[model samples]
Target: MEQDLPPVLSLDIGGTKLAAGVVTGDGRIHGWQVTPTRREEGPRQVLARLFDLGRKAVADAGEPEVAAVGISCGGPLDTATGVLGCPPHLPGWIDVPVGALAAEAFGVPSALENDATAAALGEFRYGAGRGTRTMLYLTVSTGVGGGSVIGGRLHRGAAGNGGELGHVMVRPGGRRCTCGRHGCLEAYASGTAIAERAREALATGRPSSLAAVGNPTAEDVSRAVESGDGLAREIWDETTWALGTAITDLVNVFEPELVVLGGGVTRSGALLLDPVAVAVARDAMPPAARTARIVLAELGAGVCVVGAGAVAHDLLSGKTPGKTPHA
Candidate 1:
């Protein structure tokens, strides 16, 4: 395995599940496997399962050898040191050396990247942002994460957290965000935020179809909106507005040629995109607004895995940096 090599193993670690696969040069997944995180089992247990997932993926892919391992997970993680710091989403997972552990388990080198950054790379290499020198990617799921391709390269921030795009202010003082900040874009636009807003609306005894659906999730809200439920429509509208505002800010700062929006919330598709696009066009600085195209990511749920594979491929080829050897 070498850094110049083309294909590699990819793994995606989420608060809820773990996914792994062999990502080929063509960006296709071979022997993809996924399982719940079972956080109650603790970090060590979770990593054991996560490593098993890699073995399964490798066996399934039938590739006797893989050049490297690419791992994608949430932050605040130290990609340079391959240590996962205290990520708020994954409580109790403190200072875990995930990248080094994966390398040892698999007997190959590995590279670590924030899941969002990996997604950005995956999109840049194989998805909607392909061929673009400057691109932005956001995953609006349990939380909002941002990453960018600047100067045709993934912009690894000084701390190796990539970019904390979700922390950007959209509402200023509207809701409490997970980042201990008030009214961040994540507080208003993420799937969790959408469901929370809908639940709050229901708690107010608002007349809506959502009440009938117990424990309404973001998907429920989307359905309600489609069915003309005013409550659902209102929440959905606000979500899009927050996304628009935050993205507009990013556009003004990054001047990226393309903005790729992914994650569970993006399933709303044109409903979500059209408005955000309009806002950026209308509000972003003239030059940035002129060339920026806001679109959905093409990799879908398999993005993190493929992105990890790309990073692993890079590591094997020596294109990656900041990977410390495992003990």
Candidate 2:
């Protein structure tokens, strides 16, 4: 019956990119399109382009009649009202009524969701978390973020941002986080943090391959670690340590069946996963540790697109966007 459901138009708005696609109930994406966000254009122009991109996707997919529109974006948003608060990634775009605009453009209902929270549902319903009843998804990209699926239901906490998992403090008074906190997991484990740490070490005249890079990035640090660069290895170790420590805390608190790591930083693969898995296994309470499995996300770059589509599907089916039937 799900396969007979109409395709949903999915749009993902990120600071750097905008992606659009048509997704069917089987969780496959069609007519995927991506373009640079050029966010400086601000919301009006950017949203118009995003809507056109969605139209293009529908035409390309040969499905002109989508049932609903689903949007995913970085948040501090009010999902119930579909209003985007001033997200740090999109400066000056405050209190935009994105859901109403999308529904007007497409002549259908729409649902807006926090990008990370959407990705959690995406993975849970279609990817790595397909069979799991309880899961946690952490995106360690430009910044760290996360969401949870607990007891077969997506958990959007009271504030509706699905819990700020990245803000959990790891060190009492270490590096400053974007949230203005000290020693948060984001300050230590995000891709931006990894790259910044490498650059700072190079500034001290440390010898390493990363110094040769004009502007080192997290990927550069990962590559340098693979090549046996001492300074890069140190930074990598600290990144993994911060992630493992924070995840250990989450495991103890939630006891999720799986912890799925997504986003650009997770491309490091075993280099990132192995250390974190080892730490959790070695340090977490035995019962929780034994129950949790750590793995990389399967959806990769298209995660938010697919996740938003899932939300639309739920909307059309008269189900709460993030809740499973069992819940």
Candidate 3:
């Protein structure tokens, strides 16, 4: 049945990179192409390049006639209107009618979705969350973000951005968050936050291997932790603490069957997952803790591409974005 669905063009817009591909219903991407976003060029020029990339992907995929187009990006967007709001990732890109523009370019219907939300769907249908009725996906990249699938359907909150899971408070009145809140999970756990914390520590002349590097990143901290650097270990512990604390609350509230961790920071693997798992197991309600399994995402960098393609498939089938297609 999946193979019966036509291919679709999938576009993923990120602050740093843009990706395009033709995706079949089986979750296979063909003729994938990626380029720097160079967002400073502004929306008009950037979108033109994105469209060109999509056309190139389609051609590289043997010029299959796609049924629809799907676009995924960081949100604060209007899914119904297919307009991007003031997404913090893409500064200066406000109220862009991306869906309409994509439809016009491809001569087909188009769907727009929050990147994390679409990633949740992609995992649910084809990756780590497969066979799950309820799942939570968290991406701990430049900033933190999340999406949920509940009862086998995507859970887009009333505002249509899904829940801002990153904003959950982990430490009262602590670090300021991008959302203008205090002590958000993102403020402590994001890759950006990790690097910032390390840099701030180094500025104080702390003795650590991180200080030897001209500029340190999250990966540097992770490596330092592996090499037994006390400063890096301290920062890493706090990062895991924030993530675990926030996830405990989520597990208690959502009672999901799986929590899939993805994004740049998660490449640290067990260093990140093991401690968070322990904290959640110890802190959350017994029933919720026992039911929830934290795991890494499988689709890797292609997640949003596959996810957007899934949205396009839903459009072609007349199914709601999060709902299961009728047999």
Candidate 4:
């Protein structure tokens, strides 16, 4: 029966990029494709392109039929209604019925999930949290997003986005977050925040290797820090410090067995993971800290696609809503 179901089609909508893939039972992606999102184009135009991309992925994968479609995007969205609800990343998108459209386009039922929530399911099913009973997944990218699996169940909060982990106030009266909040962890630790801090520092006419970067990105800052650039190092320290502080708080509250960090920011590897791990270990409640391991996500860039596919797979398998099947 499992083999009789067609491979699932998965789509991920991000502020900066759109991705699509066909996922098999073993959690591998076939015919993966990614393109710039160009959010200024508005939802209709973007969805058209996204659907075309999905079609291309399906054709390329040579999977003649898709049993279901799964879509992953940043929230505030309603998974129950499959509507996009003014996600800050997508600017003008508001209450767009993304899942219904996907279902119509592919002639299959569709499931929608918060991108981070989908990623959590993805990592839990096939990545770093495979054998763990409880895990937290945090994505520090264009923004900071998180999802949790508690008691071996994916926890989609009442609002369906689980929690806005980035919105945790790490500094009072600090930088403003996209969610219109001040002093949130996203204000300091996200990739956008890192780049913004570097640009702000450079604007003050300080001397550093980053000065040569023109408009330095977060990656540039990490590379500069690796090369011993003092200004970059300072910005990096603050980023890691914010991550550590927020993660420490989360570890205390959730007592997860593992915290898996993913997203573009984690590409810095040890530059980001080491300091955050140290901070969580030294700062969280001893019992929580002793039981939790902080680690990099094994799924890397394809996590969301696989996650969305996993969601679709559950649908085909007749799994009940809000239930997570064990790995």
lDDT of each: 0.87, 0.92, 0.92, 0.90
Better of 1 and 2 by lDDT: 2
lDDT of 4 by residue, 1-327 (tens): 434446999999998999999998778899999999999999999999999999999999999988889899988888877888998889989899898888888888888889998999889988999889899999988888989998977788886788877888999889988778898999999888999999999999999999987989999999999999999999999999999999999999999999999999999999999999999999999999999999999999999999888878877666514222122
Each candidate: RMSD: 2.0, 3.4, 3.1, 3.7
The count of backbone overlaps in candidate 3 is 0
- Per-residue alpha-carbon lDDT of model 2 for 76-185, expressed as tens digits? 98888788999999999999988888888888888889999999999999999999999999999999999999998889899999988999899999999999989999
lDDT of 4 at 63: 91
Clash list (residue pairs), candidate 1 = 2-316, 2-317, 3-316, 3-317, 3-318, 4-317
Scored against the true structure, residue 73 in model 4 reaches a CA lDDT of: 94
lDDT of 3: 0.92
lDDT (10s digit) by residue, model 3, range 35-115 = 999999999999999999999999999966888898999998888878899888889898998888888888888889999
Clashes of each: 6, 0, 0, 0
State how far residue 44 of model 4 sits from its true place (Å): 2.6
At residue 321, give the lDDT of candidate 3.
37
